[model samples]
Target: MDDTCAGEKSHLFCGFFLNFSLFGTGVVYTLTSATSMRAIQRANCYHRDGHDAPCSVGGDAYYMFLFGLAQAVLLQIPGFHEMAGLSVFAAVMSFFYSFVGVGLGVAKVIANGVIMGSIGGIPMVSTTQKVWRVSQAVGDILFAYPFSLVLLEIELINTHEMRFDQMKDTLKSTPPENKTMKTATRASLVITAFFYLCCGCLGYAAFGDGTPGNLLTGFGFYEPYWLIDLANLCIVLHLLGGYQVYTQPVFGFADRHFAGDAASVEVPVPMLGKRRVSVFRLCFRTAYVAATTALAVWFPYFNQVIGLLGAFTFWPLAIYFPVEMYLTRNKVMPWSKQWVAIHGFSLVCLLISAFASIGSAVGVFGSETS
Candidate 1:
């Protein structure tokens, strides 16, 4: 951002958006974890008491606080380097649950004997309402693509910069980092799109316009209660580590900018000698977790919150900055074909983002009011 933008705009806007996205992710993850926990309880209740029973597992506050406590402990893991194992575990759990969702959806669709859902999707009271829903749906989709900031954590892959030095040594034999990253990104996108399409299309086909926002947790499938429990468990486990992945960057930044070399406290262990802990990291991360949990408890509207965050950050962080930086780097002429095409694309995305923002704002505020 500093390389591309002038003056303090980078710090003001980029810093704000980056931190906001990370913080917002923590909030979403907290909500999701609580929701999943509640789903597990409700699933069990419905299974034992029958699906027709009122298995209303209300009050996610306890679950939210539990998740927050887990985060508070995990965030003390120092940095992203320590989270490699956790990341792998989370990835595995994510794939496990995604497959479960897909499989369940397929089974339900098969039982239904006909593909459900119309091309227009669920009908609304008015055209305006339908447009709002479509816009919010666009925002939800856009939310999945803003991991650009996560790539910045590549800098933290090694503490002593050994990784970069090793890469530099292998530069003659190996492809450049950018090319390798792009290749990995493309492959990941393909894999992710496959699962996303399977889960989404299958869920819609199974339940049509009446499909719940969440397939597993929304009681879309009741017969396989044990499977739902397992899926929700996977979700909880995944979010536990996924939360750390998104928040580590923010924690690192705070350590650098605010804490620095100060605020150390030495605590002795039973077997090991005294180890120094950052007093600042402890307090800040704890407070941050608590805040996210509180917000999740207060406004538990999952889809609405996601849409608002996505719509808020999509254009600037995902489209505009990258486009502007690319143009600036290559010195693309203002009236040139390449420049015009890129700018046109950005413009279209900006309009879409604006539309999404309005719709998401409506959803969030409307949900709150109602």
Candidate 2:
């Protein structure tokens, strides 16, 4: 907003919400994804005959820890910018994993009588630890869609130093850019929801009740070891892409705040003149990645971390930011019908998040039977 709205209460409040939620979200994002990488890698070990590695708080996590550290170092290469072009490979791998998971899942259902917990693939709440597990489950499921799409919207595709720049120097496009962005965002959201629902349905059906955090671990067919190994390899590739997608933004943000223009970091490459890696580049991003990897190894609870993270940020980031930013940017009166409706929706999101937060706390402190 170029400090135009700095003195205004609404604008300041929006900035606070955005920054606070984004910081929390970044940590959770890194840890959760790194944990996923660890889980899949460990699951791959299960493909070995009589050699099953446990998935949580184990040695494989250290391997992912090294992977994250290596990513930070390799990201310094100028070619790292071309990583976005590798999305085709990521997409292919994602589709391959999805098809494999679903195909095997269907065969499993046919053999196992479509064994599911309850509610169309949603699990039933058991009596033991019902309060804690059910509440945590509710929070996790609620965090799955709608507003969560805002994370992709707000952060993806070179967000111009993580702020909207009015299609000026940063975006540098005609008015149609706005329309294109909106259309793309909506389409992406719909596609994502559909795919997520399908994956959940298939995964839940494959293993029935009490599925593990990583679905690949639950498979019994170790005879096709190569296929299992390939599937887990795809998971690694997919997570590596995601690591770039998320960590680069963090690097860009910190680099800009510290060094004005991050691209100006001089690299010792003849093909690129006046580009050299600054000391800040050497130290900051490396430290950030190392810290997150360490935390991922420390608290390997994938779903719990995500649930608690969602509980804390979902209200302010997703619901509050969009509504508040809309009113502030578009100059909608706060008391108008649209404003009231938006705030009311935000209120509902806040209530849901509050319950989720409580549930996550209960899960952490109480004895979880399920």
Per-candidate clashes come to 0, 5
TM-score per candidate, in order? 0.91, 0.74
Maximum-TM-score candidate: 1
Mind giving the per-residue lDDT tens digits that candidate 1 earns over 140-205? Answer: 887876766556544333322455566578644445667666765666678888998898899999
Regions of model 1 farther than 4 Å from truth: 1-8, 149-175, 266-276
Q: Kindly list the per-residue Cα lDDT of model 2 for residues 312-334, writing each as its tens digit.
A: 66676567656655777789886
User: What lDDT does the true structure give each of the candidates?
Assistant: 0.84, 0.60
Q: Lowest lDDT 10-mer window, candidate 1?
A: 152-161
